[model samples]
Each structure stands twice: as C-alpha cells, then as structure tokens.
Target: MDVAEENSEEALLIKQHRKEKKEVQAKIQCMKNSVPKNDKKRRKQMTEDIAKLEAEVEARHKEKLEALAQKPTEPTQVSSITNGVTSLDLGSEEPVQQPRVSKAQKRREKKAAQEKERDDRIAEAEIANLSGARHLESQKLAQILAERELQIRQIPSDGHCMYRAIEHQLNEQGNSLTVANLRSQTADYMQKRAEDFLPFLTNSSTGDMYTQEEFQKYCTDIVNTPAWGGQLEIYATCVWTGGALQFCGTTGHKYREQLVLPDINCHLEDGDL
Candidate 1:
C-alpha cells in the first residue's frame, strides 16, 4: 500500500486498540467492585481475563511496530534532462566516462551502512525485550508504576539512574540535592563505615570479595565519577537522609515492596527494584 493508505490503516487500528483497552479496564474495575474480597477463585479468573486482554493489546502494538519497520524506504528522486543526451553527448563524438567512486568515499558509504544496520539491530532488540516482558504480565507491573508516580521521579539513563533517582526523591521533599553531592556523601559514608560494609561487599563481576584497597578505589570512583550506584550506595543515602526509603519492586506478576529503614537492614537487593 501507499504511505498514506498504510498510515490511515495504522491509525484506525491504534484507535480500536485504545478503545478496547479502556473497555477491558472498565470491566476489570466493575468486577473488582462486585466480587467479594475473599473470593479467591473468582478473583483469579478475573485476573486471567485481564492478562489475556493486556496480552492482546501488546500483540497489536507489536504488529504496528513490525509493519512500520518493514515499510520500504523511499528513494530520493532527481530531475533528468528531457532530451536524454545534451551535456554528456559530444557533437558526433564519444561521450566522456563517468568518474568512479574513490576508495575513501566507498569506505565512508560502507561505514554509514554499517551504522544504520547497527541502529536497526538495537531497535529490534528493544522491541523484542518489550514483547518478552508482555508475557510476564507487564500490565499489572505498569499499574504499580503508575501508583508510584506520585512519590517516585524517573531518572535519566545517563549512567546515573541510581544516583539521580535517589537525588530526585530527596529533592522532592524540599531538600536541595545534586547527584554529584549525593554520590560524594554516600562514598564518604561507606568509607567511614568500611567495617560494616566490608562483609557484604563483593565484586559482582569477579564473584570475589573486594579487598580494602579495591573497595576504597571503588568508593573513590563513586565519589568522583558517574559510576552506577547499587544497594550499598542506596543504603548509604538512606543513612545520610536519616529516614527510611521506600522502594517498590515489580515482577510483572507481583510486587515485592520494601521499606529500607536506616541502620536496621543495611543490605537489600532486589533485581526488580
């Protein structure tokens, strides 16, 4: 189909998908209100229905993406001379040969093509990841995320998601904070209380305990650079803030929420978080 026709069809599909999603959501809410709180079997069945609807919605979204990806890229058009011969034709003589592309130009073109292919691969992988997550009941997990929107601020993924997330939470509560300052403070706290963190510290990459010197270096990196923070740094930030930090964990199927109270539980790591 032509571009305009394809776009029109895609828009209609998207609108239908949204309408169905809203209807399904309304049904779910109605079911929740009518069903008894202790009716486990009925509730389980309702959950199954919701899951199926969500999966169908996700499938439609994937179909749209695949269709767009497969659409042929249009070639650029150029105007040609009407009389097919003028500039290249000599008056009753042979025409000059066209110039060949140089090796450098060919290399540049190859590099551009490779870069485009790499980007396409990345886009495909991201779509596949989203598709895989759909089967995990991401609709439920998305609800938890929506609930936390009031309290949690999203952090940019500039190699500082952890530190920036913490900083945003603190700043929201009337405290002026920067990720750099938070990182420095956390590193200092960890360094001062090395004895406490040493037992729990291990190099995730090597599966070995971090030596004192190595640990110190790691702390220094956290302080001076934009190294990604982890559970240990989060605990340090909690200590610095003098309050428990509430974290919501979602597994697509279920949520395992936690309150990280200061000094009570120094170690907590949930991949879902």
Candidate 2:
C-alpha cells in the first residue's frame, strides 16, 4: 500500500497503454489495407470490430484499477492468516512472462552510454588542444611581429644610435661584436629557453627538469646541426606546453620542425639549434 510505489505502477500503466495504442493503430491500418474501400458492408463490420476492441481496452483498464485498489498489500499479515501455506495443484503449469527491457535492450543501452561518454571526452580533448595551440601560436606570432616592427622603425630613424643596453662586463681583447661572441650568446639563450620550458614541455610539476653530464658531447652535437653547415648558420626556438607545441624563429619567420624538439624529455636529451 505504498503510495509512491502505486504512483510508479500508474506510470508503467500509462506506458503500456501507449504501446497498446500503437499496436491497435497498426492492426487497424492492416485491416484497412486488406479490405476494399468500395465495400460499405465490409467497412461497417471493420468499424464494429474496432469499436469492440476499444471497449474491451477501456474495460480492461478499469478492471486493472479495481484489482490494484483491492490488492492484498499487507503481505506478512495475509501470510500469517493463511499460515504461510498454499494447496499445490501439481498437474497445472503456468507460463513465465519475459521481462521488460530484455538482455538485448540492456546491452544496447549500455553500449550507447559508453559511446556517448567516449565521444564527449574526445570532443573535450580536441577543444583543449585546439585552444592551447591557437593561443601559443598567436602569442609567439604577435611578439615576433612587434620585434620586426621595432627593427623597421629603427632602420628609418636613429639607425646609427646604439640601442640602450646594460654593459654587465667587458670581454678582454675582444671586438665590439664578433661572430664567435654572437654564436656563444645565441647558444646560451637557446639553452636557457630549453631549461625554462622543460616543465611545460613534460607536463610535470616536480623534478630537476633536466640532467646533463656530458656537457662537451652535448655542445659538440648541437654545433654540428644541419643549420650550422659552412657558416650558413641558423638559430631556432621551440616552446611546448602540456597541450600544444610551437616553434618560433630567431632570425626570420622560418619554422623548422626537426630543430624544434618537443616534449620535456626530448628537450633534456637533444641539443637545441
């Protein structure tokens, strides 16, 4: 006699009625298709059959309500009154009814839910990747553009004036700006960039970021990069975050993927050019 349970059963009754209505409609359609429209007597007979079916459906629904209302809800009390015993009719056998939402339906629903979840995850990952890549690439491009603009402005204006710079230390017996000095400075800058971007590259929050014991070997290998052939030297820079990787130029807008080593471990092991 649980009111909540009764309400749930009522909902199931409504669902069942809807299904029955569809079946009735389909049968009516089939009957109509099987008969000739020109036959008035046959049409009248079909209408009577339909009317009887509707009446039967309504009567059954009313009977169902009455049965539910008269249901022996207090099971334990009833069982006690009957001494928990029933006379067995051993010769009689009742057919078992199949369950609602069959095994096939359950399997299909489970598969559909899994597929939906997988698709949602894929969509989220794709959006994150695209956003990260776009932001990094745009930021790098903006900075490069700004620097080029500044250089252009300088060329037309005070081209002769040496830009403001802090002279940290003086090199002994050195030219103002020798090729060796520039290379050394560029190399240091490249190394620092690699070290700083290590955590972002590796998608990690802890650790020393890099380990370099063979300093000489590392330096030698880096200097021998394809970009270093015949003093036709080139400089490269790559920055990678957890979601995306981007490579910007040192001299121009050129991008070289081979020189642009991605991932934190690669940065630690490979010598940057």
Candidate 3:
C-alpha cells in the first residue's frame, strides 16, 4: 500500500522484464545460426519475420511496462503482501517535550526532604529527653511515698460498672484513704478529696491548690491518730468543681452488690448548712 514499497515492486518487475528480453534475444540468435548459406533468400525472409516477431514482442513488453506504470500506487505506509522496509515522510503524533525536572525544582525538593528529616530528628530527641526525666522523677517520688505506711485500696466507680482494683494505703491504726480519679469520679467527690488536705495546708492558697498526693498523705495522718483508732472520723467533706484523681485499692461491693459506707469525712454533710 505504501508508495515507496510499490515503487520497489515496480523496479523488480522491470528487472524481470529485462531478463526475459535477454532470453528471447538469445533464442533468436540460436535459430539464425542453425540456417545454411545456400538458402539466403529464405533466410532473409525468415530474418524479416523474426524482426517482426521481435518487434511484436518488444511492443508487448512496452505495453506491459506502461500498464504497470499507470497502475496507481497506494500511499499507505505498510504493504499487505510484503514485509519489507519502506522509506516515508509522515507527521509525528507526539508533541515536542521539554526536559523534565528544572534545576530550581530539584533544589526545592532536596530542601524539603532535608527540612522534614531535621524536624523528625528534633522531635525524637525531645521525646527521648522527656521520657528520661519522667523515669527518674517517678523513681524518686515512689521512694518518698513508700516512707508512709501505704496499702492498696479500691473505690467503686460506676463508669466501669464492674468494679476495679486501685492503689492506696491504710495507716497504722487500720483506717484507709484513697486517691480519686477525677475523670471517672463525680465533681462533688473530687471536691471532697481536695478538702481533705486542708488541715495540713499552711495557708488558704495551699488548700486551694491542694494536690491529690498531698491530701492522701494528710488522710494517712488523720487515720492514724489515736482518737480515730481503727475507724476514720472525717468531721466533714465538701465538694467543689474540677481536676483529676487516681483511685486507690481493690474495689468490690461490700457484699457483691451492696454498698459499703464506712465512717469517715462528713464534709459533704456540712454543705447542707
């Protein structure tokens, strides 16, 4: 179908025609050599006939060549009959492309990568330092608390309807005090625990800022007092608003589902006043 390939076919046909013409010439020469000298006139007449036949052959050859030349050559790039290389001039389907990744773009990418790595390293270092400090501080704090006669205690938190065991301590006399978890315990309950530290606080500000840990210590003192003996005698308990508390001791209902109210702080009762 391609013009170039068709032209090549035409060239081959021309070559084949030329070879046929040569073979015909060789046959005529053989016939002439076979005749005798005495038969000159006959030979001449025969030669004229031979010339006419050659002319007829030549005319036929030329007609065939002209027919081939007149045949329209397809402009298609590929030939269905032949698998041959063909020359061509055709438009490219692809657009001209600019080189990828400009110098400035590369620089930006590299800088961004470096910045990300730097930030990650800094974050990791800060976290490591904080963890180390917390470890040492926790160790020291544990030692200080152990100085008091501490025991584990639990408080019922309905949030976890199934009771949980928490940490705490009973004093020498047998009365116990617990730290509270503010998130789970009621706001009023947190306030009461806050007030428990008040008697030991040197100033109103200290009481206002009383920590769960601080109140816990003072409770231990009050429980151990000779006046209280094995029973805790909390004068009153008051409830206020905010903050967190850690619960202490193993918790379970006094009798599976029954409440266990022990005599302790009465601060909340005073609030009715």
Candidate 4:
C-alpha cells in the first residue's frame, strides 16, 4: 500500500479517539459541576464513575495503538514448488509497469496531503489547549467566580475591550451610556488634565515624553479611533464615571489578553483590561 493509504486508517482512528476523549472529559466536568459539594456520598460515587470511565477509555486507546503497531505487513512469496523443482521468483520481469499518473491525480494527491497535514495540526492544537496548566487555570477561575458570586461577562477583544467592559459594568449599575460617549468623556477629561497625563504619554516611536502636539493627537485618536485604553484612559474613565473598576484573573496578579494588531491598524499599546 502507498504511504497515504497505509496511514489513513491510523489517522482516522487517532481523530476518533481525540473526539471521544474530549466528549468524555466534558461529561466528567459536567458531572462534577452539577453535583452539590455537600453531597459527599454522591460526589464519591461520581468520582468512582469518572475514574472507571477514564480507565476504560485509556485502555481502549492503548489497545488500539498496540494493535496498529503490531499489524503484520502483507507477505511476499519467495519460492514456489512445482512437482519436485523449486522455482525462485526473482524481480526479473519488467514489473508490470504502473500506469502513468495524470497531472490532475498529482494535484489531488497534493491537496489530500495538505488537508491531512492541516487536520493533524488541528488535533495537536486541541490537545495542547487541554494541557494541565490551562485546565488548572480554568478550574481556579471557575472556583473563584463561584465563590465570589461573580460571572464573567466576555468583552469583545476589539482594541476597545477595556472601554466595553467598563461600559458593561456601568450599564449593570443603572447607567445608560454608550462606548462612544465614554470614549468622548475620557478624551475630554484627559485633555483637560493634560499636565497630569502628558507626562506619562510617551512617543511610542521614540522613548521621549509626548510633546503638546503629540498629546493632543493622542487624545484625538482616543476620541475618534478604536485606540486601546491604558492607565491614562482608566484614570479619566474613573473620574468621569465615579465608579471603581476591579480586574481579576486566575492568578492574583493582573493579566491582559494578548492582542496582535498591525501598528497601522490600531494604536494599541500593551495594557491590562
């Protein structure tokens, strides 16, 4: 068999196992979350059930891998006995010539290889996403949210995440204001207190403090464009809204979602949201 055909079944099996494992993990998580902490007996039974499920799945996966590894290749006949003489079959024949592959066939093979490679990468990424480190962080965050009676309100990671999160908080607290309104207010406040903020604002290109023109342009960008907000904007926002803002993360330390935007696309400087 050709390499692609030989490995196709193995790849399919791997994909199937990965999907099954993920589903089983989700089910286990749901079981844990749905059960009350006070129900010790029920929780114990659930844990046992989860252990059994994990063992069964792991055993099945290991068996499959072993089976694939031990699979015997097609056997080739070396000699044939006719009557009393043994005739050795050497590769002497012009080995039935393989049919010439068409350009279309080559293209199809290339496409198939590319697709398989993409699928393999996707599977690897899925596994990486479920690494113990990330899973632990997720569990810790969930526990904290439950303990504090707080739920995460996912903010869009558009360069305006900070503003959107603040806007959400304000709306929840009975303030009716839009992101644009908040942006305008923040810009106006910062402009009024230019002496306070301008010292902190630095030319991103050069490491020097922003000049009067640069500071004015920065405020204009914040008011008109989707520029990312930082400490300066946060200060202005707090002053205008008269509300306290709290940032939380799995780690006690503050964290910001990583952003990747072109310099020309948005004036986004690294900052916590």
lDDT of 1 by residue, 96-201 (tens): 3335658787677566655555566756766786768653555565566778674334444445788777777778798888888888888988888887677677
User: Model 3, residue 170: what's the lDDT?
Assistant: 26
Ten-residue region with minimum lDDT total, candidate 3: 84-93
RMSD of each: 22.6, 24.0, 36.9, 19.0
Model 1 CA deviation exceeding 4 Å by range: 1-125, 134-138, 145-153, 203-208, 264-273
The whole-model C-alpha lDDT of candidate 3 against the native structure comes to: 0.43
Of the candidates shown, which would achieve the greatest lDDT relative to the real structure? Answer: 4
lDDT of 2 by residue, 1-273 (tens): 365643554445644655665566666666764444554667799989888886776577656644554656565433332331121111122322333556786666556655555566756765785667554654565676687572212111111111101011112223264334434443454555645433322213544433443333343444433123111112222222122222233323343333333343443334342
Off by over 4 Å in 2: 1-7, 72-273
Instruction: Give candidate 3 misplaced runs (Cα > 4 Å).
Output: 1-7, 74-273
After TM-score superposition, the amount by which residue 133's alpha carbon in candidate 2 deviates from its true location, in angstroms, is: 99
Name the candidate that leads on TM-score. 1
Q: TM-scores, in order shown?
A: 0.47, 0.24, 0.24, 0.44
Which residue segments of model 4 deviate by more than 4 Å?
Answer: 1-139, 252-273
How accurate locally, in lDDT, is each candidate? 0.64, 0.43, 0.43, 0.66
Superior candidate under TM-score, 1 versus 4: 1
Q: Give me the overall lDDT of model 2.
A: 0.43
